[model samples]
Target: MNFLVVIPARAASTRLPGKPLLDLGGLPMVVRTARQAARSQARRVLVATDDPTIQQTVQAHHIECMLTRPDHATGTDRLAEVTRRLRLPDGDIVVNVQGDEPLIEPTLIDAVAQLLARHTEAAMATCAAPIADAEALFNPNVVKVVCGAGARALYFSRAPIPWARDALADGRKCLASGLPAWHHIGLYAYRAGFLRQFPGLPAGQLEQFESLEQLRALEQGHTILVHTVKHPPTPGIDTAEDLERVRKILAQAVTAPPG
Candidate 1:
């Protein structure tokens, strides 16, 4: 179960500027994410950021922080830099815990890393949860994943997949009693070796149209295992409203009487 966890905290965010520094329960957002990662069984947890302020804030709490190049196009690229800089072995596992997920479950982190370990043939592993309703199934914003044979992802899209043909035919708006669909989670676990080579993979045609990074791997013919979970953890924070929601959730947890 030994693995490394890296929280990528870029300074700039279009929706929420200075997001890594936003306050969450008295701690910076990225710091809160690092704390969650630390609670996991990871052998090592570090914050990979592009801001010195973020670096100093994380280090102040005794968390390991590495300042990476800000120009990397995607979070995956940032993770690749960490792997190369640390010289992690090919077999080592690296979990990319998004910096905005302060409430992310530690168990989920272990699960994803273990998923990759169990599926040696897979270059990457990610989580997904069942789509319970047609509303969720059809929401373009809710990325859907279809699982293929051997627990690998057949495809991922913002559009609803599997068609649910007979059940949703005739413009029906409700999901069938037992429709099979999955909501893709952003979390990912990669073999350090694969991460080093990921950035060089050509941009995928589907990836360009959908703007989903995972598609790049699928398009490149790399195997990505889909680890289905009963329920997804609280999503990452993206806007002022999301920040307040998490703050309130944390506040309630603090004030609630012990069970």
Candidate 2:
């Protein structure tokens, strides 16, 4: 299956202005993200942004860059614009790699792409990992995904889902035995044609309430296939603290000798 990776990068981040260009070790954050995507099996990786600075930076690294409208309401909208502008084939797969995730694993990208290829009925595919850390499961910032049989996403929420309603009263486990609670990974893969139509869909109430774009697709009755990955969720760079944490992780990885 033909696969393309589109990264949505906006310079006007309220929390961290010029976030895509922010230094991540020796490279800009967006550049780091592009490098990770390049490692994947994607046939092409393009950075979609309205900022000239981001375009220049990405182009300087010899990465493909598409200048999109600045008024895009969401990253998904930006990606839709890229798909239309490029005239990508209807059957092609486009992976939406968040520009902030510099440490995104290439294997996870491959997994989501494979899931999309295997499931013809699924319009989109994403990944999730078991929430081993109790603290992370409760973190509102860590989006959780509940998946049903055949890898269909049941729902996504910031609140702990499959809540053990009777944990206190009946002392019974909320989730069925052997069922794992999953933490949603931001990475997404979309069928090119489906992605083109995404912008026209009405935004759903749950999407607005949770501020999760994926929910819009779910509410629209689009099936999203969710794949489980064994790897721990890598932290994305969203704020100064997140940047520092990523830097530390990268530094340690660099210093460690190859096995």
Candidate 3:
């Protein structure tokens, strides 16, 4: 099945304003992300943004982009606007690639989209990585996912799930041996029809309480298939520190001699 990648890049980030236009190894960050998405199996990649500067930057790189409304509540809403404007077929696959993720793997993009296609019952697909460190598992900012049989997501939360009660009570402050722990990755793949329907779905108590938009789908009785990635994704840009880190990584890549 063919896939269309829609990258939502809003300029008004609270933490890192004007992020899409920020330079990453000479190219704008959004453009770098688009370039990565272009490397995927997707038939087409489009950058959706409300900022004209971002749109112009993406277009200057000769990549397709569309200016969307600035009032969109979330990135998914922005992608929905793109889907409706493009008149994408209901059966077509649409992947929501975050604009900040310049280091996102193209293969992971393909993996999530293919997972969605293979699971007819699921409305969306996402990737997760096993939590290797105790600090990450306990970090509230690190979203955790619980998956049941056949990789169907049972729940997602900011708190450590299936809590290691025994270890915690003993003040071990470490992950229990033989216990499973997974952290949520922000990437997503969705059916075009569902993408259009997402904004209309009722906000559920779990979603509102947790501030996780994906919970709305689960509350509405839609299945989300969670697949594991062999490696965790390089962190996306969110704050000033994140930007500096990515810039340094890019610089190292540029100077590294190819064997």
Candidate 3 C-alpha lDDT tens digits along 1-259: 5899999998898898899989998999999999999999999999999999888889999999999999999999999998899998887889999999999999999999999999878899998998988898889899999999999999999988869888879566687776688999999999999999999999999999999999999999999999897678899999999999999999999899997
Question: Which runs in model 3 stand beyond 4 Å of their true positions?
Answer: 170-172
Predicted candidate 1 versus true structure: per-residue lDDT over 187-236, tens digit per residue:
99999999999999999889999999999999999999988988767988
Clashing pairs in 1: none
Each model's lDDT comes to 0.92, 0.88, 0.92
Of the two candidates 2 and 3, the one with more favorable TM-score, higher being better, is 3
Instruction: For model 3, name the residue pairs that clash.
Output: none
Candidate that beats the other on lDDT, 2 or 3, i.e. the better one: 3
Model 3 backbone overlap count: 0
RMSD of 2: 2.2
Q: Weakest 10 consecutive residues, lDDT, candidate 1?
A: 172-181
lDDT of 2 at 182: 92
Clashes per prediction? 0, 0, 0
Please report how far candidate 1 places residue 77 from its true position, in Å: 0.5
Query: Which portions of model 2 show Cα errors greater than 4 Å?
Result: 168-179
